[model samples]
Structure formats: C-alpha cells, structure tokens
Target: MIEDIYEYADPRFRNLTLPNTQLERLYDGCRWAEGPVWFNDGGYLLWSDIPNQRILRWTPEQGVSVYRAASNFANGNTRDQQGRLVTCEHGTRRVTRTEPDGTITVLADAFDGKRLNSPNDVVVHRDGGVWFTDPTYGILSDYEGYQAEPEQAGRNVYRIDPHSGEVVCVADDFVQPNGLAFAPDGQTLYIADSARTHDPAAPHHIRAMEVVDGRWLGKSRVLAQIEPGIPDGLRVDVQGNIWTSAGDGIQCFDAQGTLLGKILLPEKVANLTFGGPRRNRLFITANTSLYLIHVAVAGAQYP
Candidate 1:
C-alpha cells in the first residue's frame, strides 16, 4: 500500500528514477522518534525518541546506544555553522547547543521575556546565524512533553545571531510550523505547516519564501500539499533537491518544487539528514527505528 502511495514512475516525476534499491530496516522499537542528525567527526548518527525521553546514537562499529537519557524531549537537531550540535528541546521548551567540550548552553528559551512554546526543527545559515521553528506540538499533550501554559499567543519562527545573542522573529503567521530548510543558494527558505491541530480543511503543505537582506521578505507560496501524513523535517542537497520526510516516507523534490522520487519505509519517518564518508548517505529516523540509504546526491556543505 505504501509503495502504491509513493510510486514515482508516474509522469508527474519524469525526471526522477524509482530506484529498485531495497529499503533496509536498520533498527526499531522506539517510542515517538524524531530528529536524525549526522556527526561526521564521530562517524555516527543521533536521533531523539521524545516519548522515551532519550537521544540515540548509532554507528557502524558500535551499533546503537543511548547517547543521552532524559534529553529534555528533544525533537530536532542540526549542526551549527561552527559544527556545534544544536537541538530543540520540547520538555525544556528551549533551544540548546552542545559545545565541543561537551558543555551545554541554552541558546534561546524565551523571547520578549516569555517562554517559547516549543522549539522544533533548526537550520544554520551561511551568514553564521541559526533559524528554527517553534510550535506547540510538544506542549499540546503529555505524550511528547509535559503540557504547560503557552507563554506566547501564537507560534513563530526565529533567527538567532551567531555573533550576538540577538533573537528576532522571522516568520509569525503559520498555524503550526514544523520542518524548515534553506535552498542550496540560501535565497529561499522552505517550511512545512502540519496544521494538524487547527483548520482541518486546510491541507498540510510545504511553503517557500524568498530571503532578502538576511530576512524573509516575500509572500509564501505552496510548494506541495501533503496528504495522509504531513511533512516533518527536510534538508537540501547540493543539487538543490529537497529531501523531506512525509507520512509515507522520505520524498525528494527538485528546486522547482516538482516531486522527484520517494524513499518509502515500513514505518512512518519523522526526520532525516545526509551524512557518511561521502555525505551522500541519508540517515533516517522513522518511528522508533533508524534507516539509511546511499543516494546520488550530496548535502549542503555547511561550514
């Protein structure tokens, strides 16, 4: 059924190839997993099991291990411009960074003196700034995180200056912003609105906005409307293709927002990242398991 839902041989994806490569199941048995991050220095992959309240690490040599227990219900993670580990914590309702020396630093927990609802996905810009989405998905119930009063009226996306601790609201009109990533050229920012909790008639969609002078300055356009499941997290390859995790599996789209291919998995995927020796291996966190595939594309070289 998933194969039927994600077959790419359709004329709509003429430029894409539906590789016969088998989808390998790496690991499983997780409770609400999300946020797959690649660490080249350690040659490992890290992901979060929010309901389990732990961060998991997997390596070819050591297999899977608990990287951190009680990880504050981390939801998403990425490497900063300086190669530090940045994370979104649902339990803590903040964004944090893990320094090279293994020290934890709170990046942004509140804005305008009010606590953030819950930090979700994060990405770094070429200008040494960090951008992340904030929604109440983690705070809406006790399954992912402890439910608490929303410190703000609406959810928003924010940018944090790497040099200064200045945090600014970049986008504030989304019903529930989830995954986000920049184009390879950094001129466009793509964000996914799950909107599962509000306005059911509004289909979940991925939208793109132009970046001007380091700020989002254009009207948002719908790139793709997801059905059955919503888009969760995404990354851009060097060729400008978008690798995003949807309800069925991971979907690949060209720069023009045309669906290219789909990597269907047995379980629902939450997030993923490109890593490995060549940076062409896609490490996916699906449900409670970790899966990977070698692709013909490379991820953006963020340094």
Candidate 2:
C-alpha cells in the first residue's frame, strides 16, 4: 500500500507524514497528467490531460468529468489573484485566462513580435502579474503540440504585468525551466531546471533567486539537486519547504536546501499541489493517474 511508501532521510521528515493514511487513487486513464489546481468553493480538482488536448475535473462525489474539450493542448493551470483560470497552452503556444463570465482571454503569445516556443507552466502572483515558462516541448513534437521551428531565439521565463499587459523576460539563461513556486513570504522564487532530458550532461536542480522590484535581482543559486529523475513541478509548504515531483516520487526539501524526506510512489510524478479543505491533502499528477495523500502541513498558497 502507498501508506508504506515513505522513506525518510532526516528524522524531521517523519513528522510531516503520518503512518496510518493510505494513498488514494482518485482517478486514472490519462495520457499525461499535469497541473493540478483545486477549487475549494466548488469542492473539485482541475488538471490537464496534455496530450488529449483537454482539461479534466475530479470531484469528491461525481468522479471524473470533462471540464474543457479542445483545450488547445493545455499543459498547466492555475488561479489568478481574482480566482480566474490561467493556463499555458502547448498547441496554441500561448498563455490564456478564463474570465468570470466564461470568456477566454489570451494573456500572452508573443514577445518582441516573435512567437513564443510554447508556454509550459504558469503561476500568478498576488499582484495579478502572471509568470510562465516557455519551452520548445510543445512545438518539437506532435505528441504534445504541433511540430515547428521555434520562432523565438531562446526559451525563457516571462512575467506579464497585471496593469500594463506587458510581457517581459524575467530569466532566460536556463536550458529548460519546468517548475516554479514562490515562497510563503513571496520574497523568493524557486525554479527547476530540468535540462537533463534534452542534454544528459545538464544539471537537474532547483534554483532560488531573490525577487527584487518584480524582477529577478541576481543569479540564481542551486536550491536542491535531484537525482534518479528531474524536478518537473513544485510547490511550497507553509514552512517554506519545497515538495517537488521526481522520477520515483515526491521529494521534500527545506528552505535552507536540506533534503527532508521523500514520499515514494509507484510511478513517475509530473506535478503536485496541496488541496482539500485545509490544504492538507497532497494531490499528485503522475504519468497516467492522479494520487492523493494526507499531510500534516498545508500548502502556502491558495485559500
């Protein structure tokens, strides 16, 4: 059972996980599950089935349902400050938002008149500015999106101004920026560089940068080095620890870069988030299924 999958590196990790709760399989039958976001008001979870070009919903009572069909090969989903749905599209190669009235608005698609490679993952700050990662995975193959040459010279992480609607490249030196999360205080930004998938010699680590005046101030320093697999997606706990998806399972690291522990799973996890009533439930998006586990800590973001 998944309850027995816990492996502890430091003794403090034992306190974060419980011994009696079993991992629950919420749903299955997805091509590649990613970007899990929970709606507390509606009591449901929304996630992307990237290859299927759709977004799916999982509720406690109704089971699995189609939230949005023909999602433009959406890859990531998050709620903005006003509770709007912000998404990164692989096929459309853009970032979009679903307004309160159900109208779809394109948040970003191009920079400097050059089309983006493909928007992969997205996050929204309290100030309503949206940050996302642009990579070529969507345009490199048809499995995720259409095959085409990259219009932009380099794949970068960009930030869109909430008021001006201006998109600016916050960081562009990474080989591939996959996952990102802000600290509880919103002073630090953590990003995962999983370039090893394309270049075996590249580093598979998460980096931390100080956020200054809505821009990255200095060069990022290594936060944690993941082995056996790369860090795909991550989220921060209230205590500022990072819970990242790994090839084997979920790895937990402290704010000071200490490996706390790992919540092992049977499959490769792509992304995860803390949900449930009090944000104590950890929802995991693995290769083909969605899994959930209860935790003592709550997610730092969201209600």
lDDT, candidate 1, at 271: 86
RMSD of 1: 2.3
Q: Write the per-residue lDDT of candidate 2 for residues 1-303, one digit (tens) a residue.
A: 224788888887878888788889888889999999988878999999999988999998999999999999998889988888899999989999999898999999999999999898888776777889997889989999999999888878899999999999999888888888888877788888888878889979999988887655365799999987999999999989999999889999999899988999988999999999999999999999999999989999742
Candidate 2 regions exceeding 4 Å error are 1-3
Q: How close is candidate 2 to the true structure, as a TM-score?
A: 0.97
TM-score of each model, in listed order = 0.93, 0.97
How far is 185's C-alpha from truth in model 2 (Å)?
0.6
lDDT of each structure? 0.83, 0.89
Q: For residues 81-122, could you state the per-residue lDDT of candidate 1 as single tens digits?
A: 677889999999999999989889999999988999999999
Backbone clash numbers for all candidates listed: 0, 0
